[model samples]
Target chain A: MIQVAVCGPRDASEAERAQAREVGRLLAGRGAVVVCGGYGGVMEAVAAGASGAGGLVVGVLSLSTREGANPHLTVAIPTGIGEARNAAVVNAGDAVIVVGGSWGTLSELALALRSGKRVVQLGGWRIADAEGAPLDGITRAGSPAEAVAATGLFV
Target chain B: MIQVAVCGPRDASEAERAQAREVGRLLAGRGAVVVCGGYGGVMEAVAAGASGAGGLVVGVLSLSTREGANPHLTVAIPTGIGEARNAAVVNAGDAVIVVGGSWGTLSELALALRSGKRVVQLGGWRIADAEGAPLDGITRAGSPAEAVAATGLFV
Candidate 1:
């Protein structure tokens, strides 16, 4: 089964949240497992969407306790490792879907790109250097469906 | 004994590398223990400096094998957890001193701030928000001594 990691900010815009939820729902509908940071905001939204669709959801928690994870998760891996859990979140997925922008989210994107994971950026800060050169490894998705489609999970 | 964490890019500038070494050396001179990511670059330089100063060093390695750690480490923890080990690096230190900037280093700083750990920024990016407001939680230091002093380790 395809495992897709969805990441975003904890304090996100309403539209961003909706988009995250939609992405989760679509991934679940495609018979793909959803993996996330296991906290609130985009992570929670995606997990909620997948769970609502009767899909498996895995939350890679920063804390050692399962209680830190969202109730929607099918499995909560309490890493007790803090933001470092971002690597675990990316490593767990065959592809990564980033919804919003944050420093931690940026780190995950960088790690995913470094590891050669298919990254579908829905709506987030474009990773660029001082020269404003965009990291071309990331594929921009116009919508939630497009994001999941970019992951090539259906293929 | 105080445990100080020194972080920077894996491919560091010559000056940045020297700064890391000095930080380690000073920490060791003050009877403090040095902790780092334990792979290479700044970690290696700091570990070498501390070991050369007859100080104890701990390397929180990302791999499961001890061979992946710098030989200067007194104790190598092969977590085999990849970048998730950054959490382990920050969590292991009483205070953190960042030498240079990188995506991984930025993640560690964010985590350190979230954890309420005293962070001394010697020569790294001043983490700011969208409005360009600097994150005020971090203290700026002019030199290695000042960074360690800012941690209240010498106070």
Candidate 2:
């Protein structure tokens, strides 16, 4: 099964949360396994959406123990490596879908791009070079549907 | 003992390689454990420097086996998780020092900053907002000595 990593912030806005949920549902509908940070905010929202659709969701957690993992996760991997787990979250995905932006989310985005993975961004932060030129290789989407389509896994 | 992460590109310039080696030597001379990506270029340079100084060096490798690891490392952890092992490299360090730039190096810098670890940059790519303002939280250094000092681990 294709694995899609959905990344976003823990302190996410309501709109971002909704978008993440929709992205999760859409990924699940396409029979993709959803991988996420497996904590709160967008992670939980995505897990909930995938679980509601009866799809498999993997939570690559920062905590070594499963203490704070979202209940919706089908498999919880306690990495116990703190924010470093963000690398694992992106690594597990065949493609990466970014919802909202945060420091942690940016790390995952950068990691995914570094590894040459297909990345689609929803509403999130913008990164540019020192001259303000936008970094290449990231596709932006207006909605969750577009985000999933941008991954090019289903099509 | 303090564990400092030394990060840089695998395709490194001679200057970057020299700088990374010096950084490793300084960290080891101060009785700190050196952690690195465990491959070629800057990774190999740092590991060589640290090993030459009779200090402990831990190579957090992406491959599951130790096939490609540098010969100078005291310990090799074959994570087999690909670029995801970058997270473990940064996680093992109390602070992170970046010697040069690459997509992979940028990811480690971003991950280290996201985790609130102190980071020092020698010569690398720059990240900024869309408007060209530089992102905060990264300390810039002109030399390997300055980079090691900036980590604040020795003091």
Candidate 3:
């Protein structure tokens, strides 16, 4: 099954959470495995959405044990690597869809771009060069559907 | 002993390579273990420097086996997680030092910052907000010695 990594912040806004949930549900409906950070906020939202749709959700947890993993995950891989697990989350996905931005989320975006993985950003922080020019790698989408469509995996 | 993560691009300039080597050497001299990405360019250089200093160097490899690990490492961990191992590299360190810039390097830097680990930049691409303001949290150093000092692990 195609694994899609969805990255976002734990301290996310309501809109971002809703978008992530919708993205998760849509991805599950397409028979894709949802990958996430396995904590609270956007990760929990996405996992909930996918689980509600009876889809497989894998949480690449930073903890060594599944102590804090969200209940929606079908499988939880506790990495015990802290924020470094951000790299694993992005690497597991054939494509990455970012719902919101945080320092951790930005790391995943950068890692995905570095590895040449297709990345689609929903509502998130903007990144630019020293001169304020936007870095070219990410595809920005307006809604959850647009974000999934931007991944170009289903089509 | 303290472990320091050294992050940089595989395709590095001569200056960056030299700086990474010096950083490794200094860390080793201070009795710290060096952690790196375990491939070519800056990683290889840092490993060489640490090994030459009779210090332990850990190469956190992305490959499942020790296919292309630099010979300078004292330990090789083949994570088989591709670029996801980048997170492991940073997670193993108490502090992170960046020699230069690349998409991968930037990801490490971001991850380190997100984890609240002290990060020092030797020579790297600069990150700024969309409004042209430089992001806070990175300690900029002019030289390898300065970078090592900035980590605050030696003191």
TM-scores vs. true structure, each candidate: 0.81, 0.83, 0.83
Q: Highest TM-score, which number?
A: 2
C-alpha DockQ of every model: 0.25, 0.40, 0.44
lDDT tens readout by residue for model 3, B1-155: 79999999999989889999999899999999999999999999999999999989999999999999989999999999777777788889999999877888888888888878899988677775434467799899999999999998876
lDDT of 2 by residue, A12-120 (tens): 9899899999999999999999999999999999999999998999999989999988899999999887776777888899999998877788889888898789999
Model 2 lDDT, full chain set: 0.89
With a 3 Å backbone cut-off (N, CA, C), the pairs that clash in candidate 1 are none
Candidate 3 local lDDT, residue A56: 96
Evaluate fnat for each of the predicted models and list the values in order: 0.24, 0.52, 0.65
Clashing pairs in 2: A64-A80
Task: Report the interface RMSD that candidate 1 achieves against the true structure, in angstroms.
Answer: 4.1
Candidate 1 ranges with C-alpha deviation above 4 Å: A62-65, A77-84, A101-107, A120-146, A149-155, B122-146
Q: Please provide, for model 2 over B47-145, each residue's C-alpha lDDT reduced to its tens digit, 9 standing for 90 to 100.
A: 999889988999999999999899999999999887878888988999999987777888888888887999998877777643446778999999999
Kindly list the per-residue Cα lDDT of model 1 for residues A1-155, writing each as its tens digit.
78888988888889889999999898989899999998899989999999999999999998889875778899999988667788888898999999977766866876787678898888776544323345368798899988988988787
Per-candidate chain B TM = 0.96, 0.98, 0.98
Worst 10 residues of 3 chain A by lDDT: A125-134
- The list of candidate 3 runs beyond 4 A from truth reads A29-31, A51-56, A64-66, A74-88, A126-133, B29-31, B52-56, B74-81, B128-133
When candidate 3 is compared with the true two-chain complex, its DockQ is: 0.44
lDDT of 3 by residue, A1-155 (tens): 89999999899889888999999999999999999999989999999999999999999998999998989999999988777677788879999999877778889989889889999988776775434467798898999999999999999
